[model samples]
Target: MIFVNAFLVGGAICVLGQILIDVFKLTPAHVVASFVVLGAVLDSFGIYDQLIQLAGAGATIPITSFGHALLHGAMSEGHEHGYLGIAIGIFKLTSAGITSAILFGFLTALIFKPKG
Candidate 1:
């Protein structure tokens, strides 16, 4: 049940991204950015919460989830520490992702040979 729902939801999201790229001729970067922004906007309106409850990691494992995590962090911290908390929240929530990305990228570059 839960696994099936997660697969269906995650598949749907991947299909949507593929459709956007194939039919609309959008760049992959554009599609990724659009999805993330959309997720953030949806979170602002509380729509994303329901989706998460319904889909679990299907909603939390995408690039959109990154945005949701960011917005959620900011909102939570903003309530406690005011405007400054927004920045702090973003940093706290996203730092792990950003750090891992940089670390892995650097490691991959070091391990692989680049073309001239």
Candidate 2:
């Protein structure tokens, strides 16, 4: 059941992205940014947590989840330490993901050459 929910939710998100790219004629970058903003907005309204509870890793593995994590971390720490905490907490939940992306991207760049 959980697997079913995860698959459905994740697939739905991907389908939406594809629709944006194909039908709406959005660039991939635009779709990515839109999803991130949508996630942040949903989290701000306290809705994304419920989605995560319902969909588990399906909700957490997307680019939108990065926005959710950023907002969630900032808001949590902001309540404790105020302004500075907002800045500090932005990356707290996302540092591992960001670091892994940077590392793997660098390694891939080193291993592969782009055609001009």
Top model number, TM-score: 2
Looking at model 2, the pairs that clash are none
Per-residue CA lDDT of model 1 for 1-116, tens digit only, reads 77777898888989999999999999999999999998899999998888889889888888888888899989889999999999878756777888999999999999999879
Segments of candidate 2 deviating more than 4 angstroms: 113-116
lDDT, residue 81, candidate 2: 98
The runs of at least 3 residues in candidate 1 whose Cα sits more than 4 Å from the true structure, single-residue gaps closed, are 114-116
Could you tell me which 10 consecutive residues in candidate 2 have the lowest summed lDDT? 1-10
TM-score attained by model 2 = 0.93
Global CA lDDT of candidate 2, please?
Answer: 0.93
Q: Model 1, clash count?
A: 0
Q: Which residue pairs clash in candidate 1?
A: none
The C-alpha RMSD of each candidate to the native structure, in angstroms, is: 1.8, 1.5
* Alpha carbon deviation, residue 54, candidate 2 (Å): 0.8
Per-residue error (Å), model 2, residue 12: 0.6
Once model 2 is optimally superposed onto the true structure by TM-score, how far is the C-alpha of residue 74 displaced, in angstroms? 0.6
